[model samples]
Target: MSMVVTSPDFRWGLKFFKYLEIAKVNYFTNTTYLANFLSKSIMVVLRIWIFTQLYRVTYATANENEIGGLTVPMVIWGLMIAQSLNTATRPQLSKLIDEEVKSGVIAYSINRPYSYILFHYFGSMGRFVSNLISNLTLGFLAAFILVGPISLSWNGLLLGSLLLFFGYTLDFLIDLMIGLISFWVEDISAFNWIYSKSQLIFGGLILPLSLFPDYLRNIAELLPFSQLFYSGSRLIVNFDFQLFQKYLLIQMAWLVFFWLLVGYVFSKGIKHVSVNGG
Candidate 1:
């Protein structure tokens, strides 16, 4: 038998797989994260349950099909999707970046073979993958059991899941930008706080933007945070292919913009590397 030969493309594919495998190992190897995942997941279940009941009480007379421009099931399901995305891709690594920057440990990263930012980005992706699996499994079960099934077809669920993957990229980029701000500012907590509140308000965490005053809703629709949770949640609950394409293209555009912005910031930030604290 002739010796086996691997093509360049095949070799590249193998390398890519290995990269993802390393990321997985990095994320899943942590024992504390597993505990935190379980605790937060339980809290999410209770939160969703309470919200569902509040809606039911408030809309006591409304039909199941519609409530404040959204169907009952849509609101419940939207909350699940929105919260799940938030839980899965909330950019925890940004804090690590900030800590590393503060302690000057980040300088060590320069000697590593891979780009520092890309390493963090992929690490975030690995966490996203693990969080997605855990949150979806536990959150969906809890919601279904407590609030009953929210109306969504299998196709819609599949489409929403696909879009969420793209959404994670947006989340990661935004967080990376915030984390990079540590390079300029002495305190990034202010920036983090601002971003968190902005995400909640503009991303439609408690209610859909459509229910907001027209001016505010229109503004929120234009904000990048909307693409993170609001768009994905709406797509899951409503299942509009045309709308999905629209939001997907919007996310892609924002992704490119942030990617370029991060590159620029990283270039400038590295130049000012004045490491303090060991």
Candidate 2:
């Protein structure tokens, strides 16, 4: 006699597939908004153009081919790359959480069969992918038209791409933490503002660390912010093996810290949540 065996109809991986489905739905949904797409695309071109002229004037005044070891083309390309990824992880995640928390709708999601944080992350990722693709295309087109191409290396490109993934993960984790804090605090606007500005000033959003003095650059070496916006752009402008290695180490350390922090915050946040049946 033989026993017949059959697999379970449901699998753990199905939950992950749901997450992917969330991302996919968001990506396609965001792409359908032609007005938003046009506005973003136009802004990418406009910003790059304005910067290109600024770089030309600054270089003309200084009478240098490169400043702080950075060329006109280098900075332009860096801005294009930085700006492209800039829109990837928006503070919209925090706003969504804050709104849900304020509305008491988060209570409903608590009993859902999926991870709440992962649900939000995957949902945001859908929009992130849509924005990234459109921004990159416009950024590169504008950069190329105005400044010409900058030389790139295999290692630089590869490492820069990895850094972007690391950056996005860390960014999402920070947003998650802030959003979860809403369970305790009524407002997260201040937190959001500080995070945004920190990323702008220190994360190399508009200004790459390469534009700074050697001492400042050295200081940035110890900062994780530089790893987010600066490292990618730095490698784009000029790739140094030693610098790339150092950035990898810093980024990994920050990623680990934030990963643990978010877990703790989420657990605490859930306890504070008050629920009402809808």
All candidates' TM-scores?
Answer: 0.87, 0.91
- Please write out the lDDT profile of model 1 over residues 178-248, one tens digit for every residue: 88889888889988888888888888777777557788876777678888878887877778887788778
Provide the global lDDT of candidate 1 against the true structure.
0.76
Q: Write the per-residue lDDT of candidate 2 for residues 176-236, one digit (tens) a residue.
A: 8888888888888999898788777778777767677778878866776666666877785
Off by over 4 Å in 2: 1-12
- Backbone steric clashes in candidate 1, count: 0
C-alpha lDDT score of every prediction, in listed order: 0.76, 0.80
> Any runs in candidate 1 off by more than 4 Å, and if so which?
1-11, 31-34, 61-65, 275-278
